[model samples]
Target chain A: MKISFPYMGTSHIVVSYLFEKLGFEVIYPPTPSKRTLSLGVQYAPEFACLPFKIVLGTYLEVVEKGAEILITSGGCGPCRAGYYGELHKRILHDLGYPVEMIVIEPPLVEPLDFLRKLHKIVKPKGIFNLLHYGRIALEKLKALDVVESTLHELRPLALDKQQINQAYIEGLELIRQADSVKEVIEAKKAALEMLESVPADHTFKPLRIGLIGEIYVVLEPAANHDIERLLGERGAYVHRSIFLANWTRDNVLAHGEKDIRAMAIPYLNQMVGGHGQNSVGEVVRYAEEGFDGVIQLAPFTCIPEIVAKSIMPAVSRDKNIPVMTLFLDEQTGQAGIETRIEAFLDLLWQKRKKQEAS
Target chain B: MQAYLGVDVGSVSTNLVVIDDDGNVLVDLYLRTQGQPIQAVQEGMKQVEEAIKGKKIEICGVGTTGSARTLSGVIVGADTVKNEITAHAVAASHLVPDVQTVLEIGGQDSKIIILRDGIVVDFAMNTVCAAGTGSFLDHQAARLNIPIEDFGGLALQSEASVRIAGRCSVFAESDMIHKQQMGHPTPDIIAGLCDALVRNYLNNVGKGKEILAPVVFQGGVAANVGIRAAFEKALGLKIIVPDYFKVMGAIGAALLAKATVKEKGETNFRGFVVSDLEYQASSFECQGCPNLCEIVNISVDDKVLARWGGRCGKWDTLSKTG
Candidate 1:
């Protein structure tokens, strides 16, 4: 079966490997672009958020490329993301596209729903067979995640830009070659070892930057223009706020811990009602941690980020941290970003020098 | 006594608030943005000037927030220019020592803030949608020919609630019309609309985050008892709407300005005379690249004050003569 998947942060990396392992031909949508955004904006309701537009863009592009089965992830909450899959399906149907959309909701929430989704996708012979396949898939997924995380760390350290690019290409190739769970594990180990050999100058002082923002822009390389790589090439140590492990801990396990903790200080936790609290917390933490700078990345027209943007100044003041907010849209230009980044780095270096002189 | 001035110029509103050295509000004014932020800021400053007309107020610091903060800051010679999130979180923390989640649905957008121990940890904003925003409700009210002032009161009077689809404004409109055609009473439909809006907000903007108790609902929408009741029913928890709901952003800006002044020991306010000046704004689409950014320039007496919005700093560099 030919399967198509919309990009879901870095979740695609794991799911793609799993689909390939299950003997399904996987066709991933091309990286996000202006054309993708335009197409999405045209078809989607005017009021849908930018993320929805980007996702719709991916689906439309992949479906047009003749993929039969569409795979998407699902969520549940007060956030708009949970309902995107349903709305997307309706939109595609309205647009006269005949394709089966398989939404993979959080399986832990409802076991029956999870089983139903699995049945629709795989049609395993029995429960034992399904479990067996699931184990192997899970193993592969874990391995893929490990390699991706390691690469994320190394991408900012390589001496030459080409070295980082080559390392990623090699790692992706290894992932593609794995035939089983054990093979995937071995492949990940080999990829990490290969990355370790890439030479680093160790002479230049790395500018330490903390990246804080919404999930998609933080993890999706295409969405962020491979920001970590760009900054790493300039000898900056990029500290990303979102990690798969942290996400699982926060959203899956101790999901409400932050809110619960905020309860003691009602003024701070006002629950103005969304990700605004989390954004503020991350900025404050980054500031307290003494990062040279903080970059707040969010899709254009994102409300929580707007709130967070409003709050960052005081965080900057209280902790004496400098923050730069980048609002991404279809019109975001490479040169414009590069200039701002360079200027920000200059400011950071100047501050460091002034601190030393004083 | 030392004082600080903070201006928050949002797309829908412009606000100016003055705070004393101890972070106490002395003067506050909130006005419609009316598509001209310069004029709004001038008017807001005039109100602030008049309120503290006789007090020996020394402007020791000035800060700006919101979408138009940059322009307003440049015009007012602000000591600090910041974003809305930090300012709001800071003020919210100061006001309610234990605010966990901040639910702010304003004229144009909605925001959710997750706080941990007086610091913001996570946040989400809905700047693109009208469904979960006050504008959507305003539009619906105009269509229903219901006075926006009486909307919440009428909604509270409903004995039976009618269900309206709140997925999108278009969908909600059709659903509301369908309900009305089915002989649903105005009060029931209005209350149902409020519930539908609340449902849409939870479904769209608040997805995937844990919403704990001690939620504070601020912004202009907080005044609507119907929506507040709907939120309470939906979340099964009481929400605290602060006394200064409509001017929270402005108040936050004022508090931030106060903090900055205490830390920096100076101010750069242009004062109330700015209200009498003629400010003009012009925009030109940059043709340097396909981005075609509409660079906006604001000026006083043909002398440029600030230039922003172009993706590339081409226009910014050119307008540096200001």
Candidate 2:
């Protein structure tokens, strides 16, 4: 069966590597675009949040491309995210497409159920085989994060942006086409070296902006209008708090970072909803990390983020790290986003000068 | 005399302001956009030049803001392009020194800016819904058979306040009609609308942030006296509406332009001569990928100056290169 999944930044690349190991053909849909958004808008409820629409759009695009099996993660919270699997199933069925959906939740929710379903999909011969497969998947995930972080580090500093982008594309290509873990390791090393050797201008120091918010909007470039790249091009060193590997390790394995949870306790005593606690915690973490500023991005009308956004001003006031929240929807214009980013950079520049003077 | 030029070409209005090195407004022009920003900007610029016919004012810098900022920046060779939030905050703090908060409601959108020591510490913008914007007032005024300019004065004459749902424009309009049919005074209905819009802005765009004073209220809608009074009643603080409130975005832009030129010592401004030239804009769907992003191109005298509106940076990169 040709299996497909929604494109959320580099998540598809990581998952593709896993399915390849399972000896299954994977149909990777093109990156979510305006067409995908339009499709989602047409079918999704008028008041549905932006992420729901984009996910729906991706499903339509990939399904039309002849993929019958779809795998997506499920959340358990006050947010509509938990119901997306059933919702998408009905949407696909009504649209007259025959598709099988595998919804993966955190093992904490149902450990045996998660493992049993995962075993069926991977078809592991035995325990050792499962262990080996898991190791490879985790390794690939680590390498992906390394390559992505390197790209962000080099993007604004490189004299020739094309060189940075070229190295990144080639690095991803190598990993995508690699047949063994050794080749993947070599590819990651080459990518990191290429990024480091891109010849950066030392005279200019880019502003450091921390990006934190909902997993879908923060991780997916298209949903938020490629904000990271847009900020990077304008001389911002972007630090994203959400990574697929880190998120999976924290959620499924219950090995999440303890500091964030501890930091969030003052403002957010308990888990309010989907990523609500995490959003507040990440902002505090970013502030303590000496970030120049922070940007909180979430879909418009997102209840959980709305809750987090209300409490964010208190954190910003106490931390002294300027926080700007952008609520995205289908109607959001790029010019508005650009203007805000530029102005924010302007504010950060002035603040830095003021601090230096003191 | 060395001066800076700022242009705010929004969807509803295109405002232009000329400020001296000391941030004093030398000239300001406000004109309706009428769905054609290009013509509106050219006409506004022509008027500004006419007003300064005898002055040999040298433009040291140029800046732009509003929804059409990028397009206008390209047309005017702007050195700085900023968003409305920062622009409004800067202009407010400049006019009302020690200003702690700003309430700016434009034709198509509304925003709130909270400042600390004249630097913007927090700000929020609302472009998603129209319940809290000026267009809703314009629409309601037209439906009430009263000119928009007189809509505010009518509200001031109200004997008592009436409650109208301001959560959505569609609901507000129907509620207003219902109120009118029940024989409510015209002034009372209009006053309720003013109050409704104020409540909407406070609840939506003004949520979470502390609305501190000395607060400055600006933008096209600041002209409405009733809304100004509504803000005062709701916040229980004096709202300062500057003399140049309607053109504050342009003023902030000019101030920013001055700052930008001070750092660089040179301006990219094309000058008033741009008014006499023609600019053409067009769009085509890029077939480079399945995304099919519609790339728009702007040409000045048959020389393509800019291309944008693509999700991927391919078109933007190609345009800058080629």
Candidate 3:
């Protein structure tokens, strides 16, 4: 069967590799094109979150490309992601596409439910093979995250953004081609070399800006107008709170290593659903980490993020780190975002200069 | 006489401010953008030149601000190009020395700037909303057959406070018409509109902001005393409207220009004669990849000056090379 899934930055590389290793003919959903948004918007319910429409559009696109199976993850409520799977299914069915769907919703209470769901989708392959490939996939995710974080860290300090961008592209390709964990590690080192080859501004201490928000909007560059790269070019180091590996581990595997939720105790005592609780904790963590500023990006009309945004001012006040909130949707104009980001950077720069003077 | 020039090219107004080394305003000019920022900038520049006459005004640096900052900066050859929030904050702090908050209502949107000491600590802007902006008032004024200048006085003449829906301009417009049909006095309706707008601004742009005493209200909308009064009544504190409220953005830009020039020890000011140059702005959808960014291309005569709006910076490099 031809398999397909929606795109989320570099996660596509790892996903495409994963399914292919599982002996499935995977047709990766093409990078979210302009048409993807328009088509999605036309079919989607008005006021539905952005990530939902984009994913719906990508599914229709891949379905039209002769893909018979669609695999996507599902989320619990308060965020629109919980409803996305069923609604997207109905949308495709009404659009006249007869497609089989596999939705892997990680159970909040019982982890075995997640495994059972995965096993149901791949009954022929068995649990052992799934576990084996999953381990490799996780390794690949770690390597990709490292390379991406490095690219973000260095892109701001580098003299030429293009040089770093090109290196990152090549670096991802190498990781995608690697078959073993050692090869993935070697691929990461090669990528690091490519990134470090670019000349860096040694004298300038780059401003560090923490990126905290909903996972889909934060991870997908196209969704938020490529804010990370924009921040890098504007002379700020981006320290994101979410990565593919970490997210997969935290949410799906229940990897309880870093209790990010514990950081939210003083401010947000209870989970408000989705990533609302996480966003609160992230800002607190970022403040403690000595970040110069924090930017909260959320899809327009997103419930959880809206809750977090209302409480953000208090966090900014208590932590003494300037925070800027940007809500994104299809209608978000580039110039407006540019102005806000530029203004935020200027505030950080002035704050840094003042602290140094004092 | 070494002076710095600042140009604020907003959606509705194009303002210019020329300040001497001592920060005294030597010349100020305000003109309507009227859908063409280039023409407005050129006209404003010429007016500044004429206003100075033979006063030997040597421009030491140039700064540009507002929504069309990049376009204006390219056209005017600015030493520093900054956003309106920073420009407004800087200008307000300079004018009202101990200013704690700045409430700026422009043509298309409104913003709130919270400042501690002299630096902007927090700020919020209305997103793609025109309910709490100057254009909303301007539209209602035109419909009422009154000049925009007399809007404040008319609003003040009302005996009773009428309630008009100002959550969305579409709803507000219909609600306004409904209020008029209900035989509410024109002044009362206008006053209601002002109150509604203030409520909208405070709820949206000014949400969660620490608006301390000495709040400075500026921008083109500040010309209307009714909105200022509405701001005062709502906040229960007198709002300070500076003398150069309309051109505060330009003034702030000029201050930034001086600071930038001092640090760099040079100026990129293309000179006053740039008013005579032919400029054109156009855009095309880049087809390089899946993300078809509609890149904005600015040109001087036939030569391409700058290209932007792309997700990738490659198009920006093309403009630099050309």
Candidate 4:
């Protein structure tokens, strides 16, 4: 069977491996490009969120390459993400593209919904066989997360762009070749070693930039146009707020630990929920920790980030930091981003120099 | 007595609110933003100064928020500049101590904020789509030759609800036309439009997540009783409309400034005479690269107040105070 998936940062890498292990041809959407966004905007409803536009673009591209089955995450909240699958399916069907969509809803509230969706896509031989593949997928996902986390730290420290990218390519290759959970762990270790061995020139004072914004845009290199690589190559250490570990920690585990009494605190005190809370906490933390500057990234029209943008000035003043808000749309060009980054870095450098002189 | 100044410069409106030390609002002014934020702030500040002229209101601190917060902050010498979310959340919390959800629909944007235990847990905003936003409703009201203020009352008088496709402004207009051609009453069609708007909001902007009670609907749209009624019927819960609904963002910003000023032991608010300063904005496409980002520079009496919009932070960085 031929299976397809949208580009969802590092998650796609693991999902592809799982499908490949099950003897299916897995077609991952090409890395996001201007063309991808244009295609998405062309096919998608003009008013739909940017993420939806990107996803639609990915599916259209993959379907053209002969992928029959599509898989995507499902949501159950005010976030339009939950309904994207249904909407996308309707849109595609209306456009004369017939295919099956398998949505994996969150396991917390809708385990049976996920199982039903999963069963429709992959009819495992039996319970044991299904459990076996699930175990493999879980292990691969964990390994991928570990490697990605380590790389997030290492990418900022690499001497040049080539070295960091080489390490990522090797790491992904190692992950793809691993056959067992033990092998996955070994691959992660090997990837870490490769990254650690890159020569480092610790001469220039690295500009520390805290990246805060939407999860998908922050983690996805394709979405942000390899912003970390561009910044890292220019002697800056990128402190990204979104990561698999952080997402799991904040969203999954922190739910029960929240002080329910805080519900009484009115607006600012209340959780005006979504990624805004996490972003506020992260930006505040980054400022407190003395990051040279902060970059707020968000898809154009993203509400939570808009809130974050409003609050960042207070964050900037409290911590004496500078924050630049970048709204990413399909029209975000590389040269535009590079110029902005260079100027931001220069500002940070000047600010640091001023501090040192004083 | 010490007072703080708060300015919120949004795409649609610019608001100025003055609050005393105990968080009591003393002076407030709301003006259309009208394409120029610096001018709006200057004008708004003039009104505020006039309103508090006789009182012993010393401008102890200034805070700015909304889309143009940074520029407004620089122009006014604001001690604190925050986003609309933080300012709104803070102000809303102060007003309604137990606000769990905040549904803010303004002229150009709509936001759904989920609050848990007083911290913003999850929030969604709508900037791309116009269906659920106030501007969309304003357009519809204009097309129907009805004053926007009376739109809600007319909708309430709707006996039969007609379903208008509220997917986008284009679709909504066509659907409304179709409903009108079907001989539907104006009130019923208006109510249906409101219902369609609420449905679109719930389906698109207010998608997945928990929407608890004690929901406060603010911003300019909160004044629309029909939309509020639609929300109540759709969600089956009572929605609270704060007293200063239209200017909540500005109020929240003032409250934040108060807190910041108290902590810092001083205020950096420029005097109200700043309203007369000549302000201008000019843009230039940077020849630095192919990106061709049109950098916007704001100046007052030839002194650069702020520079922004170039993608690479070139201009913004120059405006930064180290």
Best by the DockQ measure: 3
Report the C-alpha displacement of residue B85, candidate 3, in angstroms: 1.0
lDDT ranking, high to low: 3, 2, 4, 1
DockQ of every model listed? 0.03, 0.56, 0.74, 0.03
Model 1, C-alpha of A295: deviation from truth (Å): 10
Residue A322, candidate 3: alpha-carbon lDDT:
87
Ten-residue segment with the worst summed lDDT in candidate 2 chain A? Answer: A124-133
Better of 2 and 4 by TM-score: 2
lDDT by residue for model 1 (A1-358), tens: 7788877555666667667656678887776766777989899888667788888998899888887788876643555667888898888888888778887655666567767878766662445554665566556556656766666566556675566557766876776677667887788888888777788655666678888777777777656656776677666778877765456545533344364326323225554433556667776777667788888887776676776777665666667777777677654535445534654665566566766777
Better of 1 and 2 by DockQ: 2
In Å, residue A161's CA in model 3 sits off its true spot by 1.4
TM-score of every candidate relative to the true structure? 0.57, 0.95, 0.97, 0.57
Per-candidate interface C-alpha RMSD? 10.2, 2.1, 1.2, 11.6
**Model 4 per-residue lDDT at A234:** 76
**Over the true interface residues, superposed, what is the Cα RMSD of model 2?**
2.1
Q: What does candidate 3's lDDT look like per residue over B161-243, in tens digits?
A: 79999899999999989988999999999899899999999998888888898899998899998898999999999898999
The DockQ-based CAPRI class assigned to model 4 is incorrect
Tell me how candidate 4 scores on lDDT: 0.75
In candidate 3 the C-alpha lDDT for residue A347 amounts to 89
Rank the candidate models, highest DockQ first.
3, 2, 1, 4
**What is the C-alpha lDDT profile of model 2 across A265-293, one tens digit per residue?**
99988777678888899888888889899
Residue B207, model 4: lDDT of 61
Report how far off residue A167 is in candidate 1 (Å): 23
